[model samples]
Target: MQQSSGWRGSADIWLQAAYENLIESGVDAVRIQPLAKQLKLSRTSFYWFFKDREELLSALLAQWREKNTGNLVKQAERYGESIIESVLNVFDCWLDQDLFDTHFEFAVRSWALQSNDVKAQISEADEIRLAALRSMFLRFGFEGEAADVRARTVYLTQIGYISMKSREDLAIRMKRIPEYVRIFTGKSPEQRDLLRFYARHNYTQEPYEK
Candidate 1:
């Protein structure tokens, strides 16, 4: 019953569909048959691209590592004249979906809870990302325990957002960016930087007054 002439789904297509399914329904629901049906293709196409379900899952994990971890490292390396600038730079990750895949982060962390291998990888990811943030703090004159604490404040807040499945509006989250910056850096974000943030986002609604 397999069509030898019709177009077949590419590897990227299968992976993307699988990734979305993982985000929406967790890893267990990412089956070849279901995805083939979703993609409107025969299930055999999956085998043409991925050797097996385990290989597809591994590919998903690799994608997550390349995207989430890679971006964190890149953000931490972006030049900042002062700590505030650097903090804002990192803030972009949360604001821009392309830079930070929080949903994917949530999915992977959920997957980690089920698999020991995944849990270890998640732990290593946490350390790598945490260390990246910690270095940012250290570079800005924060030293010793102080740097580590501030970095944790910043990194942990983001983790908490993912863990709690936060659904706050963009403008609302934007409004609190300053306070977050202040808490993490112990230095208030300059008015200009805040303005830049608003301008970059083109937000009409203001963050609620504290």
Candidate 2:
């Protein structure tokens, strides 16, 4: 007999499989048998972790809350020497998949259309995220109304990216970064800040003008 399988064979595997399945094939594809098959485990193993599909769905939502919502909040609260630096720090959310899961966020938003429970959670997520952005703007010296509008602009622009299913090439997006930062913060970014941004994104060559 095996000494002990321990938690290496535990709930996290099922949760991770369900998360991947949700991203690749939508919520409906996160079934026990399919995931078990993908993991080369028996369907019986799924029950060892999740009680039922509803529990699995709940786990998926919680995962999004922790990763997507949590990431946004962290970025919003990030400190930088200048407002532009702070904004660029927040922009890292878009570039780094580990810091922010756009696929998972979009999937959860789509699922919200069919489930009021999910809709409520997503709505709260939106409010929390937007509030964090607004606070960041406020901290940067923008007054109440201007900060609110800027916050909406930043948040809604990304929401639009998700809704439109935008796939603009990275170079194209990089070229527009200056304009985006200008509009969101109501001030042009410093040349040094722009250069740093490009360097971090590995686009040190002169970006094509758009």
Candidate 3:
């Protein structure tokens, strides 16, 4: 058996390299040999922590789901004050160019299309995120069906922003989010202004179009 210390170190290196490669290229571009080469390790080192390419890929996808998607939803739940803010934060999190990028979003979406396990994992994450947003909307005063619609709209906006590649375009798109929120929540100008101020200062601009 491999020493515990050596085993963990190798696993960490492998995951870090794999995630970088996935973000730079795409899921299909991630191969065991290339990842091992990037880490200056032999293929045997990869097998020490992961049984094969499939296992490594599975772990990589799981990590992406957990860190990129799951953690955001969890944090929003913890920090958000109003239902509107909580729901808006979900979009804000996805739009964060520093934390999230077009390539990373594409990697997840592409993996979902190619792998059943990946699709299920992403679907589960989406469900949780959407549910949390929906609940936040309800708490902020939106009714049953309307909250659901607003939650879906928020999800769509995130996806839309991810499709664009320019920072300037992204900012333009983000500027419109407040309007959508106002329409969904029926907030007056004062309420809309307050929300916009909070969103602008608190969150990163949406990915693409700065």
What is the TM-score of each predicted model, taking all chains together?
Answer: 0.92, 0.91, 0.76
User: Model 1 TM-score?
Assistant: 0.92
Clashes of 3: 9
Which pairs of residues clash in candidate 2, taking residues 3 or more apart in a chain or in different chains? none
Off by over 4 Å in 1: 1-6, 204-210
Give stretches of model 3 more than 4 Å off.
1-9, 79-81, 95-102, 164-174, 188-210
Residue 123's lDDT in candidate 3: 82
lDDT of 2 by residue, 8-117 (tens): 35687778888888888888898888887888887776677677889989988888899888998998898777778888888888888888889998889888888899
The parts of candidate 2 lying over 4 Å away from their true place are: 1-8, 207-210
Give me the candidate number with maximum lDDT. 1
Model 3: lDDT of residue 46: 73
User: For candidate 3, lDDT tens digit of each residue in 82-175?
Assistant: 6545556555565564544456666787777878877788788778778876777777778899989887777766666555643555556556
**What ordering of candidates by lDDT runs from best to worst?**
1, 2, 3
Q: Rank the candidates by TM-score, best first.
A: 1, 2, 3
| Pairs in steric clash, model 3 | 166-208, 166-209, 167-208, 167-209, 167-210, 168-209, 168-210, 169-209, 170-209
Model 1 agreement with the true structure over 106-190: per-residue lDDT tens digits: 9999998889999999999989988998898889888879988887888888999999998998767887888888888888887
- lDDT score for residue 152 of model 3: 78
